[model samples]
Target chain A: MDNFDKIAVIGGGSWATAIVKMLCENNSTIGWYMRSIYAVEHIKRNKHNPNYLSSAELHPEQLDLSNDINEIVGKYDVLIFAVPSAFLNSELEKLNESLENKVIFSAIKGIVPETGLIVGEHFHQLYNISYENIGVIAGPCHAEEVAMERLSYLTIACQDEKKAKALSKKIKGRYIKTKVSDDIFGTEYSAMLKNIYAIAAGIAHGLGYGDNFQSVLMSNAIREMKRYIKKVHRMKRNINNSAYLGDLLVTGYSVFSRNRMFGNMIGKGYTVKSAMLEMNMVAEGYYATKSAYKINQENGAKTPIIDAVYEVLYEKKEAKDVFEKLTNMLD
Target chain B: MDNFDKIAVIGGGSWATAIVKMLCENNSTIGWYMRSIYAVEHIKRNKHNPNYLSSAELHPEQLDLSNDINEIVGKYDVLIFAVPSAFLNSELEKLNESLENKVIFSAIKGIVPETGLIVGEHFHQLYNISYENIGVIAGPCHAEEVAMERLSYLTIACQDEKKAKALSKKIKGRYIKTKVSDDIFGTEYSAMLKNIYAIAAGIAHGLGYGDNFQSVLMSNAIREMKRYIKKVHRMKRNINNSAYLGDLLVTGYSVFSRNRMFGNMIGKGYTVKSAMLEMNMVAEGYYATKSAYKINQENGAKTPIIDAVYEVLYEKKEAKDVFEKLTNMLD
Candidate 1:
């Protein structure tokens, strides 16, 4: 096994903290870079990420923590980006060092708002990273569950099977399991698409639809996801696989999903602006829905769920009326 | 359309009551028969099923209720059997009337214990009913949801598309939507198989697995169901359809599911016998697991979920130990 030694995690979100926690189990000196100097200092002093995943005890001795983006990017053999898709551009703008040789894996689950490209495609198109050197960390695994040491599954996808397998070994632990897939585009797109579906689920739930309807909505959502992904990246893959349907189920059904929370408020008659304000953060799916709707204009897939979500979020339609129209479209 | 008039519901359970309620929206003088004479009299007097779905009002003026099975079977053109699989044989034993001419549709979600066949197959093999005459009503629906008048979806499947469509029209109402399918065997098998998976889900929850694990288990289950159904009956069908995956989700995730409740108790360290004793009722999945395990032995589909449930429920294996082994089998 060709072990790529210095692996660094970028971003300071809950997912980043969680990924670093997983890497800590296998790697001795894991590199962690965040934009926040205070978070870096806090972790070094308090032994945990105070802003996110606070309950997860971190080993400061095992970490090579820094806020300098260029230093970590230059030193690391593999860089795993966990930043929100909306802010990924600004974080990369601070980087003066080349990413040509550094293997990149994204834990982000949305299209980059600036370019309307998935993180892997963004790196490939702009940063000139080869597809083999780029990878994706897709999750049915939630960061909160990881913090609780609960059993969770992650999919490591890279065109190169060897690199995917190597990364899988680094993340697998007593409570975490990893599967490797060559369908990087499919996995990444499914991960981004599921959040939009989760918002649809939350809106239906908030509109007084019961569990029976929710189950039907989810069944339809997975099929819609399969159709949409196949249009973007044609692949021979099972849509029922844990990476695709499993990821959708966890986000759509989980009470802890922020996208669902945002959608719930929208369904309860709050405008998109009000819902975002109430959440105090923008959901990844909000950007994903807009980008996906635009992409589907060229790559046509019958995406009723996505259309309903987009109409409610960006078009500023009433969630109740949009969802009412949606019920007829689903099986 | 070939309309089959004089539709009758044969059972006194909650499902039978819900079906009768759906029928009442389109049909007048719906035939209803049960072995319980007191319950039949109570419904006639109270205008509702006193024992089940008590909240759903029944119009006595439109119903032809009887305790005599022959009277209802002899008069009705279409019979929807909603009896428990265990009691189905006994229910048929009470009828001296021939069912060869009647179009039979089953709402039962288990295999016949005596025949080790799904309800549709059981009726076909033993009762000499033609495949075209036999049908299935599969659901992502709950009887409780119907009682509450919540929107729910149903799949009406028959080899005869006309029969399926006609029956779908009879059942479709303000709160219920129906889809027609021609895969009677697959839908009926999926209905029975979903119970076993629900038990697997319950055992996992009982043994301390979280939502992440449950999502993966369900995703794996739908794939396993697709593989298993294909082996038994070779057909072209989307396993992600509401009839398959939607039904599984409703049964697996519902709080009202007795199978889950039973499995939860077993996971909490209650013995199978003790769990049954405490509930004072046997879960349909308990019988389903045994039958499905036997069927799979011949079919040769890899079913770790069903096997694990069987070991815990029938083979007297510990829940923790079996689930520990199961975790490794799932992705």
Candidate 2:
């Protein structure tokens, strides 16, 4: 618990800012690392994140901000990684400091693109961090909701109960509730897989399905997620828990979800490239679908939803045709 | 299967009309009984129900319509009851025709107020209908969605597989998909219980909780539902199925759900009486919560969601204070 007191959040996204906001409530000073020097100076001059979660006021006095990743990593005992999965490799390459001794927790919700490993496994396998030192932070939460001080729930999963408990205490606040789990693999895999399902939800919505079908799709999605997760890491975890199903619901049903928005465009007949170009961002699900589909090929889980989305995005099958087939597959 | 071929829909509500619409797709002649002679005449002339789902065009040429309950019951081999649970006893009071030979399927999703049992159980215990002859028609399919010809799924649950399959065939259409289940008790109980959870959802939204909390509440609700159903009817069933979780989602999330709307009003500070008076209809959950609460006292399932809604609606507990306590109860 003492080692976890000097926690540093890595990345400058909305989710990272939100985590910092939560940590600021419980800590006298928190380590924050971002690549952009201007953003670091902007936060020092102005007590708010300029790029993301702009309305969330930061306590600069309580923040030990740095543009250099190694400096922050060297100073903090616990490093919470929150960068996008696609950029995780490059971010880690910049870190000369050892994560071998630190209690590492991933606030990242994706599989590292190069390795097809979740951030926790990526850290454990590549960086030699023990499973005991690795943990995951998950949510049925949105960063925007945190900015508004709306009530939200987070699940912290670690093999070490004490480490998970310590992190939970730091993150929980008046509007934030926390629970601990030992299922790191299931929670992280679910966190990554939900983006893909959100895309499926978007496609269904874009293809003109109503609330009735959306409900059914979600019901099936959770079951499919359970099946998929079981293949990767067989555990006795309840898939209906808030960390899995609750997170899926918030992402799939949320209008603010970029993954769902990307899917909506696909369902509305936008090519994958066009949808990404128009949005000026790559949806995390686009990459996740490819990775999960490939991973399922080895595990051999019967995943019709993932298969359909893969066909539409990777195989260039028409969204109409793919979802038309998906309709017969769900119930 | 042959005995269930001659079907009569017994109600004048939107749900009854929706069932008739599905039946008309496969049957050349279907019997319909309504208490309102005016509604029967209106449908006969206008090809749509006058009071509900007016947009659905009925096929009068294939319809055998009457106001007399006995006339329809005497002629048809299968009777599907879709009336409000509160009015069911009065409607059944008029049925002098024996139900001993008939196959009964309930589309009504509430407990019988007088008997405090699910409609399927009420028929089995009181009307002397064999469990094999009783069935339940459940939805993640809303009546409104059926009217729009939006693709939806229905679960037909009967102890007798052939009867369930036959009913599924009669109702399945281009936009309608059907599956059969043998767990009649579980399905009926879930059908009744979802409304109570929907009411709970409305109260949360009414009290200004955001989507993050709603998702967590639903995740907890399904888990609570699985636990509650197991106590009453111990069987091998996945509570995440379309008939259970999917139906719960449609009701809890749909803007069209009267129970949710009723809960929203209560959340917004309307007393139950005022909310009922304003809507000009009773929210079925108001009564269902009472029945379920009393029943749970015997079973003693640890159902926090149902308990909270029951307190708010029946015990006159303040929605704000009750929900504040309820939030801590959910994950």
True contacts kept of each: 0.86, 0.85
Q: Tell me the whole-model lDDT of each prediction, alpha carbons only.
A: 0.93, 0.93
Off by over 4 Å in 2: none
Candidate 1 — which residues are off by over 4 angstroms?
A: A1-3, B1-3
Cα TM-score of candidate 2: 0.99
TM-score of chain A of each: 0.98, 0.99
Interface RMSD for all numbered candidates: 0.6, 0.6
True lDDT of residue A289, candidate 1: 96
Candidate 1: C-alpha RMSD to true structure equals 1.3
> lDDT tens digits, residues B263-313, model 2?
999999999899999999998998899999999999999999999999998
Give the per-residue lDDT of model 1 (tens digit) for A1-331: 2457789999999999999999999999899999889999999999999899999999999999999999999888899999999999999999899887789999999999999999999999999999999999998988988999999999999999999999999999989999999999999999999999999988988888999999999999999999999999997998999999999999999888999998888888888888899999999999999999999999999999999999999888888888888888888
DockQ of each: 0.87, 0.87
* Model 1 Cα interface RMS deviation (Å): 0.6
Q: List the residue pairs that clash in candidate 1.
A: none
